[model samples]
Target: MKAIVIGAGMGGASAGIALRNFGWQTEIYEAVAQVKPVGAAISIWPNGVKCLNFLGLQRQIKAIGGDMASMAYQDYQSGQILTRFPLRPLVDRVGEFPYPTARAELQSMLLDEFGRGRVFLNKRLIQLEDNGSQVTAGFADGSTATGDLLIGADGTHSMVRRHVLGHDVKRRYAGYVNWNGLVEIDEAIAPANQWTTFVGQGKRVSLMPVAGRRFYYFFDVPLPTGLKQSRDTSRKDLKRYFTGWCAPVQRLIEQLDPMATNRVEIHDIEPFSTLVRGRVALLGDAAHSTTPDIGQGGCAAMEDAVVLSLSLRAHSLGVEDALRRYQESRVERVTSLVLKARKRCDVTHGKDPLATRQWYHSLEHETGEHILNGMAETILGGPL
Candidate 1:
């Protein structure tokens, strides 16, 4: 069998690798003239790690990933640690420690594994056609590819998703602006192996370890959508928004290179009832885009890749049947996650002031185990 994978991102590349493992020929089409990582870093939780292991990229992921051993939540202004917890218990329970990896390194590893020749650049998908037995993709560059199945991994603003639903699905703004980038690891800011976060006033500043003695950091402010943001004024903007934040946050803003930081207005789509139509199926953010509140966005994408491959392997019925099986298996799980993340986003960002204050109070009184158990619930629910 043959498959056409759209978008050469985390989901698309993993789908290509997984399908190939099952003896299917696959080609990945990317929209950009040159491939680049969209963000600074990503958290691959235990479930995501298990999917990578299944794809035979465990060694590569570990090589390019961070050693995250603990987590901490602190008051944004005072820098007082509200709670601190060792992640060892969660790691032991899930059988894998979550790795915070540089986006560039992780993308490079997946592309290398998928093989450069199998991935075509500058092929923006303009249209798709499915005629029961075979599916075809039309590119903006006036090129076309036909295969037995099509997997749309094109991200939140996905064209492929539009074709499947026969309508444009509006993306919901998560009511925040985010600035993220890489900075040299400094213990004065946080521990070398801890994921530290500071929260207050509907805002957040976080730093997590990544490879090569560096920290992947991000700042979140609950701002109105469509607010003007300029790269030239990024540092100034962050400084203004985080004026009363802790010393570590100030240091982060001062130390970061504005030119290198990525500013994103966060958005997510409501979960769809179906992710498949005939031989075409959606994967990753293309299937279910969610806010990063719970940190499972990429992990869910990896899960999709594995489940799609498994459905194909198990169902000898046909391409459409296999796609339907994949959809049925994923819709509930991904919907729950998307809704959960949305709720978490509201709580953390002060959309629900009562919930946000309650969460802070809970954190202060929390033992390490409660936090770890919550994470474990998400990690253990994976199809792996």
Candidate 2:
């Protein structure tokens, strides 16, 4: 089957890889002039890594940043430990691999696997029309292309969703914003694989090492939905927000600097019900956009690609059977994650000081394997 995949991001590239693996001819289109890692660091859970392994990209997975320490947890304001989960014991229990890596590494590896000249740059999809036995994608360049099957991996604000869902689906603001930035891996940081979280009034921060020399931190703060801050805001402003927290946070802000090339992320996100409509399939943030509270945003997108590919490969070419089945397999899992992430955001940013965060942190260790294993069973149960 000739397949046209839109939006050359993680979900789109992954769908292309899966279709190619199934011996289908695939064409990928990206709205961007060039596709690159647009986010900071990303952590791939064990279930998502299983999909990468199925695609034979385990080496790239291993080459990622630091792994979680055997023990991970959240803390209270009283300096008391709350929840602790042993992550090392759950690698295979979860599935295969679960690691946090730089965003560029994952994007670059997928681009390499796609080979050169495969991704058509600057071809923004304008609309899609079903032509009985075939689907046609209309592009802004006034050129049109047809394929036996079309998959829309356009993220968050997907154009494909507007085309297929018949009307515009608005993103629901979860009433908070995320503050994400990276700092040099402090030479003073003694914990090699440790990751930690601290929750305070109306704000929460989670920190982990993305690479040997750099650590990534994202703070979700309860804010007005439509509030906008200057991209040129002084780092001192961010410093003010994070002041008097953990030593690691203070040190991180002291060393971190934002430049034109790097952005200190501050944006709002909401959850979507489902990303698929008719023959057009939505993947990643396009379908389910959850807050980054649980750090499952990117990982959920990676899993979406894997599941969509498997569903298509299991049925006849250009058939709606597979698409319907894809929706069934994904809706519950993706929606569940979306809700879970939002709940985390709410709790983390609540006004309980660090009490709630610490209580959950203590539970993290006990539930780590169970959570990872549950994700594996949910997403990997069907065909790869």
- Model 1, 1-384: lDDT tens digits are 999999999999999999999999999999998999989999999999999999999899999889998899999989999999889989899899799999999999999999999999999998899988889999998999999999999999888888889899999999999899999998888999999999999889999999999999999999998877878889999999999889988988989989999999999998888799888999999999999889999999999999999999999888898889999999999999999899889988999888899999998998888878878998888998
lDDT, model 2, position 12:
79
lDDT of 2 by residue, 22-136 (tens): 8888899888886777667777767677777777787877787566665444442443444556565566454465677777777888878876478888998887987667889
lDDT of each structure?
0.93, 0.68
Q: Candidate 1: lDDT of 140? A: 94
Give the runs in model 1 whose Cα sits over 4 Å from its true position.
none
- The 10 consecutive residues of candidate 2 with the worst lDDT sum are 260-269
Model 2 misses residue 154 by how many Å? 0.7
